[model samples]
Target chain A: MKFIHTGDWHLGKLVHGIYMTEDQRYLLNQFIEVVAEEQPDAVVIAGDLYDRSVPPTDAVELLDEILFKINVELNIPVVAIAGNHDSAERLSFGSSWYRHNHFYLTGKLIYDFRPVQIKGVNFHLVPYAEPGHVRHLLDDSSVHSHQDAMKAVIGKMEQNLNPNEPNILVGHAFVLGGETCESERTLSVGGSGCVSSDLFAPFSYTALGHLHSPDAIRHDKIKYSGSLMKYSFSEAKQRKTISIIEMNENGSFEIRERTLTPRQDMRELEGHLEELLDPKFYEKQKTDDYLKVTLLDDGSLIDPIGKLRKIYPHVLHLERKIESVDQKQLRNFSSIKEEKKSELDLFEQFYREMTTAEFTDEKRELMAGIVNKVLKEEAQK
Target chain B: MKFIHTGDWHLGKLVHGIYMTEDQRYLLNQFIEVVAEEQPDAVVIAGDLYDRSVPPTDAVELLDEILFKINVELNIPVVAIAGNHDSAERLSFGSSWYRHNHFYLTGKLIYDFRPVQIKGVNFHLVPYAEPGHVRHLLDDSSVHSHQDAMKAVIGKMEQNLNPNEPNILVGHAFVLGGETCESERTLSVGGSGCVSSDLFAPFSYTALGHLHSPDAIRHDKIKYSGSLMKYSFSEAKQRKTISIIEMNENGSFEIRERTLTPRQDMRELEGHLEELLDPKFYEKQKTDDYLKVTLLDDGSLIDPIGKLRKIYPHVLHLERKIESVDQKQLRNFSSIKEEKKSELDLFEQFYREMTTAEFTDEKRELMAGIVNKVLKEEAQK
Candidate 1:
């Protein structure tokens, strides 16, 4: 059984206040082109089909269009699940009826543990669910974190596993040791969110989402297909690709990666403003690419962003690196200072700083009177 | 061939700032019961499934649950269309794949005019479309109004009609002579929106939505199922029902109405506040029903709405009849008085009313100076 594995489309993503729907649409069209050429037996989308719970109408339309092309037009079975960003109820709409057309879309987690069988492979789909939901569903009070929730759900699937058949697990989780990017939402506050790679030991291959890097984890069986594009500047260096897996009768598989060229590549540049914008240096580059230009100039520059934007029309971020460092230090010092002062003391410090004068006894008495009135009002409330 | 006809669910409607989702859900559940008991060959939802173009998530869920029960679980076919309030693109999502399961959902108008044939009956679906869309689709510049748009669409469907077979036309439009209520949105300005009933003369039966009354149009073959519940105070006395049609072999049909009991019926009451709330008058009424109380007492009443709400918990509107009548007349007189005056003249009249003083020439000069300055600023813009 051969299949194309992809996830984290994140349709309707807004980066730096610009809607990325057009860019996503262009790349998704290319993905359909790849599917046409490869003609895989099935397409497995791990999770995170949408960037938000209630996505804009266009996002919903785009997903609908692409899914229709693949499953209805191309006549290939599609197995998909809902991720943390998706509203399970919304995504689940029309899912039961969609199954008749070889489209398997799971939103909420179920204890039935039934796999969607396609071309002899048992594809176990585990949609993302909150710990509370998993706890109630499994009747287990110990499910307190994402890891616990995934373990409990997977444990139920394991009970009905067919050891002889080629088994594949598709999930959205923060696996232990997987590198994350700025655009990926944190599943939990601490390490408790990370699930061990060993949990997939029984499967032939475990396709994952959440971490936005193709090489997020090191395990041979556990792999991340990564996001469809560079959602953030932190992911500028990550090579985005779709994984194509070929499984043998014995449950062994060979995974191959196919790279997709984005309409506009996300990139970061560091240099003096003048040198970075010089035609001789930028003439050969992809000028229309989304850029984050960091200026290293020590002195003040007049309308730096305005000047940079003239050449790089898609410049998303512009900053003076030296000034940002100074501002960071200043922010840290002020926060520490603020932590040690009471409301009245902070007010007094602000007043003295503004006037550049010593605190007089009369001014202190007036400030005390104002503070007493505020305290009285608060107590009454 | 027999089918249950219903429309204008208006799910997620907000009447007087309260969401009517619960009441709509209760009534729709009863509608499902009727479909189950009748065992219709198919279920035809004319249009306006949602109250807004973008329905809330709960509304989407309810529509999904009910459709699933009718189509997948009950093994009945569902034919539906997009109404004026629904975004055609949003409702068209998953429609292509849904066809495999005998769920035909049409949104945007298509020129192909392909009829969905089920149980020897040909159902031609014409979803609501703007004049511009019909003009472009049919390549006819003459389509300039709702009437013209419907004429062009139905004209195309008529060409493909099989006269030997039972033909049913499902639509969402304002028929020329339909009695409309305040809750139904006007499709267009003036009389241009009214599509003549002659447009449906070719079909065996015309199932329509948009108007909120069951007996909106005086046509034997063309009928409305009415809204699921009373959506406005003007519709308080309207009887809401589901139309069940039983068609014979030669396309002749018998239409039956099934009235659904809502969780709380909407009603209007008029009397003195004291008399209306007295146990003698209220004991025999459905006190929990949604009420619009009009007070008749000619004296001052303290906290009337609050007091009425104590007895009629679902009181949605409260007004004093005499004061309202007086206010209406005053409003008309004031509007007519204000319409014939310039900005300065209106301002001077307002000043006199507030201060009970004459409009002095000095005050007029000052007001003219401000008005001129505002006009000058507007001219510059």
Candidate 2:
């Protein structure tokens, strides 16, 4: 049996205040192309199909279109589960009817733990659930964390397991030792979300989501397909990929990675403003890529973001690299109480602090004229 | 071919600040029993399955559970459409896969009008669409109102109609001359939402939703199943029911109404407070019903709502019916302008207006003492 293992599509994700649905649609189109070419027996989406419980309409539509293409248009069985970012009830809608088409989507955890078997391969789908839910579900007080919740759920499946079949476990969890990025939401306040990798010892392959790195964990059977694209600046260095697994008649499987090329890469750049904006510096780079640029120049620059935007249109973050701030702060101290000063005086003080330049007589005169005109308007009101 | 026609469930409806999902669940369970007894060939849900575009999680779960019981468990086909309140794309999700299980849910209006056939009956589903959407979909500039939009959509379907088969039109529309209730949202600012009943001339039966009254329109073949329950006080007198249609081989049908008994009935009670509280008058009434009480006692009352709540726990609204208002008005007039008067003076004037009594010296002394205490506390602050 062969299948494409992927998760954390995070459809309708917002990165730096921009909706990523179009980017997701583009990448998913590519995914469809891959599915069409490979003709995999099944498509296993581990979890986190949406970025949040209530995703925007476009995200929902995009997911619908992609899932239809894979399950209906391409005629492949899809096995999926709801992650923490999803509303289990919302995702579970139409799931029973969908199963007839070989589209199995498990949202809430069930104690029976029936495996969906196809072509002699048993796929155990364990959707993400809170420890409290597991505790109540199993009538066991010992389930107090994500690890314990997963253990209790998976342990129930093991009891009903057929040892001869090539077993595969699909889950959404933060396996201990997996590398994480900023965009991945913390499942628990502390490290209680972490589950041991030893839990998947019985399965030939374990497809996981939650952490954003493709190489999040190192094991022959356990793997993270990673997110579809870089969701945060912290994941700028990560290479996003999908995992393809081919299982033999025995329980052993060979897993390979296929890298996905995002429309524009997420990257970080640090340099002097002038040097960074120069045509020679950015000509070879993907100028439209989402960027976090840090200015190395010590002095204040006028409208630095406005200037850099001409070269990098998608500049998401801009900040100055302040060096030796304590030395300059000590030299520029003044003892004028802000509450005792007029609006013009406060404006002058703010100008001096930002520019480290004197409030000249000409500028002060202009400021005073503006303040008077504003006060005159207020008096009339 | 036989089918149960129902719509305007408004599943997460809020009536008088109370979520009506529990009541809806209670009634829908009865609807399931009706379907089981009838063993209908299909269940046609016209539109407005939810109260809003985005419903609460419990509403979604309830809809899912009911749909599952009908389409999967009972193996009955379901034909549904998106209404004005529903987000089309969201409801349309999983529809493609659902089609295999004989569950057809149409959201947006498509130019291609295909009939979903079951048991020799061809059901033409027309989901609600805006004038702008219909105009764009048909590329017809003449489509400017709800009537015109419905005309254009149904006109397209006419070309593909199989006249030999028994055709049923399921829609969410405000047919012209339909009596609307307060809970039914106005489809348009004026009368543009009204579609002529003549549009359904080609179909054997036209099952509609939107209007809360089951007898909203007077036509032999065209009808509304009404909302699942009375959503507002204006609909308190309206009997909520589902329409069951049994169609014959000769393109004829018999429609019967099945009354749904809600767990709690909404009613209005008008009488003197003392009379209403008397067991002789109240013993025969359903005390648990949601009640709107209009007190006929024109005198000053202390916590009338609090008093009535002891007998009627679900009393949602309360008001006093003032008799001979001119008598009270003549006694309450004073020379002092309301804006210039102190809070205590304003309170005294309000009391006089309500009671038609003079502010006696003893009452005045008591009022002065309370005012002085309040002022002292304010001064300390």
Candidate 3:
């Protein structure tokens, strides 16, 4: 049996406060094109299908179209689980009915060890779980951390496993040696979230998520397919890939890595404004790539995005740097500064530093009065 | 052909600021019981299955359970449509695959009016459409009102109608004489939103939504099933009912209204608190009823909800009335009447009215400064 293993689409991701929905669609379309060409027996999406729990309508519609194409049009079984970023209840809305059509989607942790059997192969889907939920489900007080909870979950899986039959484990968690990107949220504190790969050795092949790099973690049978796209600038150098696993009659598995081609590469450029505009500096640059351009101009550059996108049409982000002016001139009036200034003065300084605007004495006096009133009320309390 | 015609379940409605999910469940269960007992040839839910476009998770789960039971377990067909309140794309998510088992859910406004032929009955489903969408779909700029739009929709329906076959039209809209509760949003101004029943004269019967009263609108072939439960306090007197229709070979339909047995009755009690407490006042009250009690207690009653629920058990809303206070009288204040007061006086009055505690002199001075500063800035703007 041969099938494709992919996960962590993170459909509505925003990088550095910039909306990445358009980029996400471009990359997801590439995945679809690959699937159409490969035509694998089945598709297993491990977890983190969405970046946020409440995805926008457009992202939901895009995912809906892909899922419809895969399961309905292609007639291939697709199994998916919810990760830490998803609201399980929302994702699992019609899962019970969806399973009738060989579309296995599990968001609730109660069915952690219930393997979905299709054509004699058993697929055990384990969604991400909290330690508290694990402890409550296991009815054991000893499981206070994720590691302990995972051990209990593995023990439960052992009961359901049929050693003679082929079995595959799909999960979302941090395993040892897993190279996590900046976008992957911390599951727990103090490194307790990471679990050992040996715990999942029982399965023929374990597909995992929670790490963006496909080669982040390595074991004999465990692997991370990585995220669908480069989510952060840190992952720009990473070669994202999906794993295609083929299981023989003897229940042994052979895994092959297939490189993913993003629609447009993600690139960062930093230099002085004049050199960036010289055109000679960008002879080797991929102009169509999504760009993060930072200008080192001493003063703010006019229409930075317009200027950068002239050479690179997909300039997704732009920032201007203005050198700080010397403040030694203020040292001459330091005598009065020793006195306790009103809170309004502090507000004015903060306003000036954060926003490009002018402040007046009347506004300062008003802000100070409001702050003083609140403080006075707090004192009475 | 025998069928159940129900609409506007509105599963997650809030009545008078009190959540009525439990009451909603109660009536919905009664609806299910009716379906089981009647054992109709099919179930047709017109539209507005959810109260809000973004329903709560529990409401989604409840609807999922009912649909599974009726369509899968009982092996019955269900034809539904999207109401004005629904997000069409979300409702149409799994509709493509669900059509195999005869669950025809039409969220998009199809222009051709292709009827779903099931068991020799031709069911034409026209989901609620905005005037703008109708005009765009029909490619007629003159269709600027709902009446004109709906007329065009029915014209499309007439083109596809088989007069010899049993035909039924299911829609979500306000017809003439349809009494609407506060929960139902008005589609357009005046009578423009309401389409006359004569539009469906060619069909055997019509099932309608967008009204909470079963008896609000009536015709020989057109009927509203009404909401499953009283969605608001204003609908306290509504007798929630579903229309059970039986079609004959000659394309004629006989309709009957079946009252729903709710798990707990919803009622409103209006009287003086002292009188309400008297056993003679509420001799007919269902003790376990979900209630909204309006007390004419002259603002003398303390802990009204705490006091009323002791007897009413489920006092969902408790509003106190001390005769009808005029808005002018309510806004009349001693501070406003004072002469030549500064911004400090305004701040002090505002603080005093909103808080349980008083403001100090320092705080008052600070507030005055802030208000003055804000006013000065506004003047410049």
Candidate 4:
């Protein structure tokens, strides 16, 4: 069974006061052409169908047009789930009728892991949920973190799984070793949102979303197709692509990447303002590409952004390299400071603020033991 | 064939800083019961599915649930259209696939009126559009007012009309003699929006919306089902109902009103603050009904709304009777003053205001001729 794995379209994303709807539409039009050529058994959009709960009207229209073209016109089964960015209820509208034409869109998560069976392959879709919600759904006190929630969810799915048959899991989470970048919202306050790749061992392939870079995590069976486009300057170097996975009869899959040409590439440039603005230098670059330019000149430059925009119409952001160098040092110093604090000391402060009770030696020792156990478990994963 | 004609749902309506979603849900629950009992062949919702272009998420959910129940669960066909208050593009989502399930939702108006045929009856749905939009669609320079737009639309429908078939026209417009309430938005600045009832003579029945009162216009063939609820204090006295029509094989129909009781009835109350507050008066009434209290007391009352809300949780508005009486006379005098002006005199003043060019004798004679002709046309209708 062949599956085109893609997600994190973020259809109505806005950065630096500019909407990405047109850019999204341009890529989606190209995506439809890709779907037409590939003719996969089904398309798996892991999650994050929209950038916000209440997307703009044009964004809504664009989604409607694209979904209709793929599911109706192309006659392909769309297996999708709503991510943290979507309002589950809004996305669930007309979903019951949508299934008649093989368009499977799951917004709200359910306790039972009902797999969508298409051509003998069982595809289980798990939409992003808060740890608290998962805890409530499973009625388990042990499900206190994203790892625990995934463990509980996988446990449920495994009960009905046939290991010999092909099984694919589509999910949105911060899996272990997935590199983080700007524009991706932090899943939790503390470091409790990461799940291990070992939990997805039973599945032939696990198509994941949430992280914006395709190189976020690397496992033979688990992979990230990445976001449809670069949403922030931090993601400038990462090339976005959709993974086409062909699962063999023996439950082994071979994956290939199909690069999508964005309407305007998002990248960064660093140089002195005058040197960067020279006609010979500017003419050689893709001036219209969405850019974040960093000026290295020490002296002040008047209206540098305005001057750059005359050439690079889509220049999203401008910054001073000198200021960033200072900020980078500050960030490094802060991280070192954060790491220096012992687990018990951090817990004591957190507990003091969260509760009225005193942090006794007995409580401290118990917490220390638990923290050590968690560290050992994380290392093994 | 039995048809339940209803319109102007105006879901997500906000009045006096209160959301009408819950109340709308309550009424819709009752409406579904009525539908279940009647088992109508098709439920025709003329227009105005939402109060604003972008409704709250809850409103969308409510519409989804109700439509699902009526069209999917109960197996009754639904015919609905978008009104001036709706964002046509938002409503058009999933419309192509919806037809297979007998859910006919028309948002955008096409040049040719395509009738949805069900049970041997042709139902022509005309969604609300501005005169300029209709003008652009028809490419007719003469389409200047709502009347002209409707005339052109009806003319297009007539070209494809088989009058012998039981034809019913569903539209949203301000027909002539429609007694509009405060909640109903003025369709046009002048009297040009009023379409004569005689123009709808071809269709066996013309179901209209936009006017909040069912008695907004009076004709045997043309009727308004009225808005779902009392959306304003001015609509306090009007009774809201849905029309149940039985169209015979001969293209004639008999209509009956099925009154719907709102969760909180909207009504006016005239009394002194003390009397209204007294247990004797309060105990005998439904205090929870949405009230527009007209206090007869001459003196000031501190925190009257807050005080009244103790017993009447939905006291929507409070006003002094004396102040309103004075305002009513002012309104009457203004209308009389407006009526006293001659057409030519008003035109010259209007012409002087609208244009820099002088109003010459030739222009005055031409304006006078047009005004007289319009007056004669209006009189004949």
Worst 10 residues of 2 chain B by lDDT: B330-339
Better of 3 and 4 by DockQ: 4
User: In terms of TM-score, how similar is model 1 to the real structure?
Assistant: 0.84
The runs of at least 3 residues in candidate 3 whose Cα sits more than 4 Å from the true structure, single-residue gaps closed, are A16-19, A294-306, A318-381, B110-112, B279-284, B296-305, B318-381
Single-chain TM-score of chain A, each candidate: 0.86, 0.86, 0.79, 0.84
DockQ ranking of the models = 2, 1, 4, 3
TM-scores of all candidate predictions against the true structure: 0.84, 0.88, 0.82, 0.81
Candidate 3, residues A1-381, lDDT tens digits: the string is 888999999887887676667777877777777778878778999999988777777777788778888887878899898988877767876676677777898876884576888667788888888889888988989888778877888889889899888888889899987877777887899777888887887788888878888888768888888998888777877878888888875679888878767777887788887888787878877788877787766643577778777888877777654334235423422443675766676566545533335677877778878998999999999
lDDT of 2 by residue, A250-276 (tens): 988887778777888899999999999
Clashes of 2: 0
Candidate 1 lDDT, B1-381, residue by residue in tens? 899999999888899999998888888888888988999999998899998877888898899989998898888999999998888877888999889989999977876798999999999998989999999999999999998988888888888898999999999999978887788886678988899999889989999999999989988789988888899999998989898899987999999999999899999988998897799999988999999988887646788988888889999998765543345544754786557767897787556543445689999999999999999999999
lDDT of 1 at B328: 57
lDDT (10s digit) by residue, model 1, range A1-381: 899999999988999999899999999999999999999999999899999987888998899999999998999999999988888877887888888988999987866798889999999998888889999999999999887888888888889899899999999998898986789887778887788888888898998988889989989899999999999999999989999999987899999999988999999988888897899988988888999998887655789888888888999998666543445544654785648766677777555433345678998989989998999999999
Cα lDDT of model 4 by residue, B226-307, tens digit: 9999999888888799999999988888999998889999898889888999999999999999999888765446888888
Please, what are the lDDT tens digits per residue for candidate 2 over residues B111-173?
A: 779789999998998998899999998999999999898888888888889988899999999
* Collision pairs in model 3: A366-B370, A369-B366
Query: What's the true lDDT of residue A302 in model 4?
Result: 86
Interface RMSD of 1: 1.4
Instruction: Report iRMS values in order.
Output: 1.4, 0.8, 1.6, 1.4
Model 2 misplacement above 4 A: A323-381, B324-381
Candidate 4 stretches greater than 4 Å from native = A110-112, A135-144, A155-164, A272-279, A298-303, A322-381, B110-112, B138-142, B298-307, B322-381
Winner by lDDT between candidate 3 and candidate 2: 2
The CA root-mean-square deviation of candidate 3, after full C-alpha superposition on the true structure, stands at: 8.7
